[model samples]
Target: MVAGTVSGTAEWSRPRATHAEVTVGFGTDDTTVQVRSVTTTVANRTELTLANALVDTRLQFLTAGEADDLSVAADGRTRTYDRTVTVTVTLYAGDQDTETVAADVPVEIVVTNEPGNSEESGGSNAGAT
Candidate 1:
């Protein structure tokens, strides 16, 4: 198992062997993120699974604001949202044979809204013209 950290706006890439590459993307709500493996080792026969605090049993990306909203709801405040995601890769080596690797990745979702600069911070114009 491997452990690491990633940001919401970045992609994490892990290369295995000489021709296998694992890429993970934390896409925005409007973006379609797909987990795929390009490898010559197993002829592209690979399965990817992504599990996190907000997702499970599948590989997918959270929406742009989804993580931030979840963090706020969980703690009544949001600034830097943090979550742990686990990625599992299963490679089919041959008939009835396979190899699996798991990684525990920490993700940091940055809330772009700056305090005192947004209405949510009770700015002077919060309720005024």
Candidate 2:
């Protein structure tokens, strides 16, 4: 695929009352993807963000302690000492786009810090021992 900042909105073809799966990858740290919450069953449109909806995996080789020293950008605010997380979204399921009718759905990704480590240094000071 392409490697760059993933922004903007993409459309997916998902059916009604169905769930879609998404996976995300982070940098060379213990960062991970998480879905805080989701609003999937009420409106025809589903809204997802860092606060809700996330990748379905975690980071290895990165210690749980070190992960506590992560940060994510959200709503023009810098979230420090947060969970390094990523997000993936399934716009639709099948084919929401047809020559006859077309529908474009949108999803949001919000990065934030994870809560757990209450006394660890916010990392960011990697040098040497």
Candidate 3:
């Protein structure tokens, strides 16, 4: 995540990723998240842009067989799993030709299973009829 500030400000504010292209790459798939391309905007803040960008790239690295293997079910309900993926984010300055910074970042994603409401069970529910 890119953060910046002008300083000398009382209240802190979240830095915006402006004037740059965020490129996420996983294996052979690569996708660029533009500043203006956002899934949702709340109070002028972009939501899920970075997250969606990362997921899109990660999906390319998975094959049909690999995806099927990763899916699992427990107690007749699918369970979510966490996977750590290595990705590279390239930051450009003004233009793609001008590469200002690049880094390999590890992204952890929670892969959700099929839609189902799961009931919580444990010590308290052990003896409940």
- Better candidate by lDDT, 2 or 3: 2
lDDT of 1 by residue, 1-129 (tens): 112333232122332322223445443344424443333343442333232221322444454455334432322234564555544344443443245555656566554332234466664321110
Candidate 1 — which residues are off by over 4 angstroms? 1-40, 43-60, 64-78, 115-129
Candidate 1, poorest ten consecutive residues by summed lDDT: 1-10
Whole-model lDDT per candidate: 0.38, 0.33, 0.32
- Model 2 alpha-carbon miss at residue 78, Å: 21
Model 3 residue 36 CA deviation (Å) reads 21
Q: After superposition, how far is residue 45 of candidate 1 from its true place, in Å?
A: 14
Who wins the lDDT comparison?
1
- TM-score on alpha carbons, each prediction: 0.36, 0.26, 0.27
Residue 24 CA error for candidate 1 (Å)?
Answer: 5.5
* 31-120 per-residue lDDT for model 2 (tens digits): 333323232221234433322333322224234454444434232344322223344454433434211112222222233433333357
When sorted by TM-score, best at the front, the candidate numbers are 1, 3, 2
Q: After superposition, how far is residue 88 of candidate 1 from its true place, in Å?
A: 1.5
lDDT of 1 at 48: 30
